[model samples]
Target: AQTIHQWPVAEIKAVGSPLSLGCTIKGKSSPNLYWYWQATGGTLQQLFYSITVGQVESVVQLNLSASRPKDDQFILSTEKLLLSHSGFYLCAWSPGQYQDTQYFGPGTRLLVL
Candidate 1:
C-alpha cells in the first residue's frame, strides 16, 4: 500500500521568517508529486510538481519553492514566508503513468503572524 506523510501538522510563523515543510510517499515507484496551498477560506492552488527525481516544475510560484531530492520525498521551503503565505499546505501523489487522479494526505496548515 502507498501512503503519504507530512510534517508539522500546524505551524505559527512570523512574517518574513524562514519556513520549511516536508512530505514523503512510501510504497510507490516514481510517483508524480505535487504541492498545493490553500489560503484562508480560499480554494486550493497548485504550487509545484515533479514528474521525476531532480525535475520539478512550478505550477504557481506564490513566494515559495519546492524540491524533489529523492524518489519518495519532496520538500517545500522559503527564506521568507509572507502573511499571504499563511494557509494550508498539502502534499499529494499519483501514479506517474496515470495523471488523472491524485491522492492527498493530511496537510500542514500554517498561520503567519
Candidate 2:
C-alpha cells in the first residue's frame, strides 16, 4: 500500500517572505512525482514532474521551483511568494514504469498576506 504525505495543511504568509512545503511517499518505489497548484477558485495547474531521479520537467512556470532530493521526497518552495502565489498545492505520484493512475495526497492551502 502506497501513501503520500504533505505538511502545513494551511498557511498564511507575507508577500516577501520565504516559503517551504514538503511531500513524501511511503510504500512506493521509484514513483513518478508531480506538483500542482490551484489558485483561489481556479483550476489546477501542473508545476513540475519527475519521471526518475535527476530528471524533472516543468509543465508550467509560475515563477516557482521544485526539487527531488530523494526517491520519495519532493519539495516546492520560493524565496518570495507573491500575492498571486496563494493557492492550494497538491503532490501526486504514479506507480513506476507503469502508466497507472496518479493519486493526489492531502494538499497544502496557502494564502498570501
Backbone clash total, candidate 2: 0
**Each candidate: RMSD:** 0.9, 1.1
User: Each model's TM-score?
Assistant: 0.95, 0.94
Per-residue error at 3 for model 2, in Å?
0.6
lDDT of 2 by residue, 6-106 (tens): 99899999998899999999999899999999987888888999988767889988878888999999989899989999989999999967676899989
Clashing pairs in 2: none
Query: Ten residues in a row with the worst lDDT in model 2?
Result: 94-103
The sequence of per-residue lDDT tens digits that candidate 1 reaches over residues 6-78 is: 9989999999999999999999999999999987788889999999999999988688889999999999999
Q: What's the true lDDT of residue 102 in model 1?
A: 93
